[model samples]
Target: MSVVTEPKLISGNANKPLAQSIARRMSMHRGMSVGLVDARVERFNDQEIFVEVYENVRGEDMFIIQPTSNPANDNLMELLIITDALKRSSADRITAVIPYFGYARQDRRTKARTPISAKLVANLLTEAGVDRILTLDLHAAQIQGFFDIPVDNLYASPVFALDILHHFRGQLDDVMVVSPDVGGVARARELAKRIGAPLSIVDKRREKAGEVAGMTVIGDVSGKKCIIVDDICDTAGTLCKAAEVLMEAGATEVHAYISHGVLSGPAVERITNSVMKSLVITDSIEPTEAVKTARNIRIVPTAPMFAQAILNTWSGTSVSSLFETDTLVPIYEGMYSRD
Candidate 1:
């Protein structure tokens, strides 16, 4: 496939603000009026999604910015319909920019009759004519293999690390990064390495989904400022419980940095009432009213990183460099620099 100079951005109803932010970042980088494509994504009386592209996109590089977050099925269907519309409109290349990919937790079958929904979602997107996939912090890294097309899984660790550094202001003493579970040790370790902090793990057993049976701290956290790092925080039972456990273990204070804040059910309440000082989440998934109003919850923007990623993908440049600790500072500074 040949490269297209002008890229067209299209947004679904999933997260319009984030899409707009990405477009603004792109425009700032390119020094041109790079805005979203003129398209109408709406629903009928019976809630059937309908998409119509008003502007001509023939032979144009197209990017659809839509995260399949809450109301997962509706948003997922909207993405498919949008992709189909773009394909039929003769767009040269179609890339789906999904910040938060739904059905990711169901990457594998846990029971006899269960299905691998993550793979199924990938197949659906492929069948819908998505040429490339760009997502952030997938629950499982192996989910990339589910797609036959090119998959670019971006890490939020660099962004998280910058925020953590800014929050702590170079204070590395008595700080600890804790993984909520054994599966998340890698993610936590990456953040710890970036911030030059010690790493710990919370060994937890799950009786079922969203319920923690028991937990054990794998490292010393006594009298230290504990920071829990994880990919997703749904229901937040494990997260809140882990924070309580850390306090009981004599930690001075606790905080959390999660990539995707699913925050379903009693998650917000749990975080609000828990011993954690603050819960910082990325804006991959749009924050709901509860999340926005939560006292101790904070959000870090991902638009700059994603905007840089999209530009890299469009220009055939290296996307991995954005996550490198040394390179990330200059790149991030450049994003906000007026020069």
Candidate 2:
């Protein structure tokens, strides 16, 4: 029989608070004191990255929590360097827990001569010695095919579903889930199914990135409370525009629940000025001060879900079961009830 090692957790500079939260949840799950691995990830004078592991990881299972969010290149480099360091140190296996996968939007080429950067990132991670991948809702599900290693692509819908239930208690009859664009209908449909709500899609034409030329609502959102669901909200343009169309279609109110809040550029400002009633996002990427102070923006913690995922991965259990709404409702309800 082989020895089973307790998973060792480590993190890069991308989102330390989220890493710490996951560690705390893991400790609770194990019913013992579990601490993060003592490691140093820093930058050199010339902006080069450096990683040094203080503890011995020989034959140990290691998990690195890093989201390649803002300053994507630097964080991605840090994850690669940390994986390389752990590999050289003889860790038995390394799993990268990327809450927000940067460059994922570039999974395919819309035109000739453009590089598929997501595939390139996958190659880099594989070459750097990642044994597996644990990530939340990727921008495109097909991006999972870019990797050779086993990848557990988790969903934020369960968590969002629980939140919607809590906020819309006794109001489900008024709720309707909206997909901001045609491509996101599937994601929106999943949430709609979970909440037992009708689904609507916003058919839009995008001339280019960050610009929505025009849009039309594809369903009867009239007199209904609309909840837009999406994977990433970078500039918030699509979401804000979708909200406008929904309200014009007679939606009583509009809200959004997004997986990765990549609120870059004027995203926060746009959200503030938009007609949407609220914007709910997971803490996949660290929130900026502007995001924190936004009146209608709320962050739902994802640490508990990710912590459970890590525990399941370490024990060689079925991670896909966590995706079921029946399995997640009680888990998340217990977690948020304390708050």
In order, the Cα lDDT scores of the candidates are: 0.91, 0.92
Model 2 weakest lDDT span, ten residues long: 330-339
Which portions of model 1 show Cα errors greater than 4 Å?
Answer: 1-3, 334-339
Q: How many residue pairs clash in each candidate?
A: 0, 0
lDDT (Cα, tens digit) per residue for candidate 1, span 1-339: 655778789999999999999999899999998899989999999999999999988888999999999899999999999999999989999999999999999999888999999999999999999999999999999999999999999998887877777777645687899998888999999999988899998899988876688999998899899999999999998889999999998899999999999999989999999999999998999999999999999998888888988999998899888877566666576432222
Q: In model 2, which runs have C-alpha deviations exceeding 4 angstroms?
A: 333-339
- Give the number of the best model, judged by TM-score: 2
The TM-score between candidate 2 and the true structure equals 0.97
lDDT of 2 by residue, 63-88 (tens): 99999998999999999999999999
**lDDT at 164, model 1:** 75
Please, what is the TM-score per model? 0.96, 0.97
* lDDT of the structure predicted as candidate 2: 0.92
Candidate 1, residue 28: how far the Cα is off, in Å: 0.5
